[model samples]
Target: MLTKRIIPCLDIKDGRTVKGVNFVDLRDAGDPVALASAYAEQGADELVFLDISATQEQRKTFASLVKEIARHINIPFTVGGGISSVEDVAPLLEAGADKVSINSSAVRNPQLINELSKAFGAQCIVLAIDARKIDNAWIVHTHGGKNSTDKKLFTWAKEGQDRGAGEILFTSMDHDGTKNGFAIDPLSKLHALLTIPVIASGGAGSMGHFADVFALAKADAALAASVFHFGEIQIPELKTFLKNHNIPVRL
Candidate 1:
């Protein structure tokens, strides 16, 4: 089996790394460049750097910041926020992002996924879906989880796959920052429905949570923010724990 990945997400707002609960009540985390370098040295399998406010604020991701972070981290890096078209992706790739993630923009123009996948190849197009359970349905959200969309999580994820997205980065707004656990049921469903890798995000509070996401949900990767940012969990130790549990991870 392919080794599962552990990714640390750096949510950027106002040029600083931040963390929030359910996509609001944001708090400062640290300098992203410093954090990226640290995670690289400590053995993070990959890094996700998102300019969290770029979409809501009506701007593109900080390509300069992406460049700086990429310079520091040797691991695979995915950059996102405000990416909309093939035009938006080129600079980020040139700036050093191994892959580009798109959320609100992709939802707005599903064709953007095909265009990006065609232009950049499916290997580098990550479709990020942020959803919240509303009235028992997992409804997709946009503009950094502020607006509700008619798009349901399962259908939209499958549509994204058909559009040639390389991976699905699903963030459950209901579970985000709760530290309870990952949204296992939906994740498992996504795992079974999609052939591409699924990167599970939000609600990672402990090592056991990571184990459960992989063991139960069959998620390809597990991503977290606050736990890793606040030193609540360290990547090397987490990898050791997963290795002991027979969850394939790179230590």
Candidate 2:
């Protein structure tokens, strides 16, 4: 089996790293460049830097910060927020992002995924899906989980894969920042239905929660924000705990 990955997400807003509950009530975390570099040194498999407000604010990503953070880390970094087209990805890649994540923009134009993949490569694109449980099914949410779409989560995942998305970063809006645990039912369904990697996000409360997501959800990777940002969970220790649980992980 491929070793599962542990990734730390840096949600940037106003040029500072921030964390929030269910995608609101933002609070300062730290300097993104500093945080990214620290995570790299501490053994984070990859880093996700999301300019959380870009979509809502209707602006481009924080290129200055992206460049700064990229310069600080050697590990692969995925940058997201307001990335709308192939042109948007060029500067991000040139700025040193290994991949660019698309959320609201991709939902708005599904074809954008195909264009980006063709222009760059499937390996350079990651589809970030934020969804909420609605009427017995997971429904996709856009603009940082503020709006729900008619599209079903599973269908969207499959569509993204068909469009050549290399990976899916699945985050449950209901579970985000709750620290209760992951929404495993949806994650498991996604994992079984999609061939590409699924990165489970949200509600990772403890070391055991990490174990549960992999064992139950079958996620390729697990991502968290507050727990890691506030020092509630440390990357190396979490890897060790996963190792103890027989979850394949890089330590």
Candidate 3:
């Protein structure tokens, strides 16, 4: 069986790690580079650095931060936020990011996915979808979950795969920072629909949530921010918990 990955997400705003409920009411968690190094040292499978305000602020962010974090950690990391074109990806990768995640930009121009995949190989292009349940449907939200689109979650995910996205990082806006659990139903549905890896994000409150996401939803990876950022769960301990539950994970 393929070992599931545990990713620590650092939501950056003003160069600091921040976490919030439903994508609002942000509060500082810690310094981004320091947090990245800590998680890497703690046996985190990978790190995701998202400049949370990049899209809304309308600026390129994280290149310098990515480079700094890269120097401190000897593990793969992904940088994202306000990345729109193929030009935007090269600098981050050159800055030492193993991958680049695109959300709002990809939603605005679906061709960006194809262009990026063709330019840098599909393995490095991650399509990040932030969605929320509304009116009995999961609608894709953009601009860091401040705006909603007509696109449905499942359909958009399928389209993203066909468009050459390497992996799907699905964040449930409804469950974000709630400390309840992951959105298992949609995660399971995503796994059923796609061949590529599906990363379940949001609402990771405890170690049990990690096991549930992998054993129940069968997510290829579980990505969480507040839990890891606030020291509520340690990556090494979470892996041990998963292993006890008979879930395969790198220890």
Candidate 4:
């Protein structure tokens, strides 16, 4: 059986790791390199570093910070934010990112997905969709969950897969930073619709929440930030807990 993955997200703004509720009221967490190294030591399956303001500022990702984090961690790392074209992906991969996640850029020009898949292969491209429940439907949000796109979550995910994206990182804006629980209802709906691996993001408060996401949400992986960054939860211990609960994990 394929073991489920636990991922830690680092939202960097102005070169510092930060966290916020529903993508607002940001607070500094720590240095990106230090946090990446710590998560690596904790046996996190993967790490996602999103330069939250890259697109809004009309700038590329932080290659310097990427290099800094790359120097210390050996695990698979994904870098995202403001990545529009193949050119933007180069610096990130050069800085040692195992995968490049595209959100706003891909939503604006979906062909960017085909181009990335052609240039870097599907496995190297990750399509990240930040969604929020709107009137009983999940609407796709872009620009660090600040703007909404016309496409729905399911349609986008299916199209992303068709465009050759290897995986989808689906985040729930409502549950984000709430530390209540993952939005399993939408996650399960998306998981059932997509064949590509789904990485669930937002609202991971406890080990039981992770287990709930994996079991009920049918997510291939769960991604969280505040809990792990603030030391509220430990990755290895969480893995053992998942294992004890009969969840398939790399313990």
lDDT of each: 0.88, 0.87, 0.85, 0.87
What C-alpha lDDT, on a 0 to 100 scale, does residue 103 get in candidate 1?
95
Task: Compute each candidate's TM-score over C-alphas.
Answer: 0.91, 0.91, 0.91, 0.90
Comparing 2 and 4 by TM-score, which wins? Answer: 2
lDDT of 2 at 45: 95
TM-score of 4: 0.90
Measured by lDDT, the strongest candidate is 1
lDDT tens per residue, model 4, 1-251: 89999998888886777664222222323577776777777789999988866454433337778887888898999988778889889888888889999998999999999999999999989999999989988999988788988999999999999999999999899999798999999899888898889999999999999999999999999998888776788889999999999999986
lDDT of 1 by residue, 65-142 (tens): 777877777889998887888888999899899999999998889999999999999999999999999888999999
lDDT of 2: 0.87
In angstroms, give how far residue 65 of model 2 lies from its true place.
2.0
How does residue 64 of candidate 2 score in lDDT?
Answer: 69
What C-alpha lDDT, on a 0 to 100 scale, does residue 160 get in candidate 4? 99
RMSD of each: 3.9, 3.8, 3.9, 3.9
Compute the lDDT of residue 98 as modeled in candidate 1.
96
Mark the 10 consecutive residues where model 3 has the least summed lDDT: 20-29
- Candidate 2 C-alpha lDDT tens digits along 49-133: 8876645443343776778777778888898887898878999899888999999999999999999999999998999999998
Worst 10 residues of 1 by lDDT: 20-29
